[model samples]
Target: MQVQVKLFAFFREGRFIKEDKELPTDTTAGQVIDDLNIDREEVGVLMLNSRHCKFDTVLQEGDIYAIFPVIGGG
Candidate 1:
């Protein structure tokens, strides 16, 4: 299955902002994060096809997944 991944904020540093990825069936959002070497604690939001989703959410083929890092400011 193929899915598009979009990284936001500091997540894009030293990496791409968006790219197509081929994953196995029944792959979860958390797996992708791990494959990308992103810390789960740093993730602020996970979106699948424009809707908010959890890390355990199962990804589908052709789905658009976006990951945003947590932002902190005073």
Candidate 2:
């Protein structure tokens, strides 16, 4: 199975390019990030097709996902 992953802000700054990634069956968003050497702690929100998702959220083939960093208060 394959899924599209979009990394933003801090992630992109970390050298991650937004691209379609091939994920194995039963793989979760966290797993994909882990495989890519990304730390889940750095990501504030996770979305699957624009819906809030968790790290444990299992990925489906052809699914689109976006990850964003958390902004702190002034």
Candidate 3:
């Protein structure tokens, strides 16, 4: 399946802002994060097609999956 992955904040430091990924069937959101070497604890929000989702969320073809880093503020 092909899914569009978007990274926000520090998550895009050494990675792209957005890209289309070719993944196997049944691939979860966490799996993609692992592949990108992103720590689960650093994840602030997970979105699938603009809706909040979880790490175990199953991704589908043409899905727009976004990952945001935990925001830190004063």
User: Could you tell me every candidate's TM-score relative to the true structure?
Assistant: 0.94, 0.85, 0.94
lDDT per residue as tens, model 1, 2-70:
999999999999989999999999999999999999999999999999999999999999999999998
Instruction: Encode model 3's per-residue lDDT on 1-74: one tens digit a residue.
Output: 99999999989999999999999999999999999999999999999999999999999989999999887679
Task: Please give, for residues 1-74, the per-residue lDDT of candidate 2 as tens digits.
Answer: 87889987778875666788776799988887787677878879899988999999998988998888786667
For each candidate in the order shown, give its overall lDDT on alpha carbons.
0.96, 0.83, 0.95
Name the regions of candidate 2 deviating beyond 4 angstroms: 72-74
Instruction: Tally clashing residue pairs in candidate 2.
Output: 0
TM-score of the candidate numbered 2?
A: 0.85
Higher-lDDT candidate of 1 and 3: 1
Q: Report the Cα lDDT for residue 64, model 2.
A: 91
What value of lDDT does candidate 2 attain over all alpha carbons? 0.83
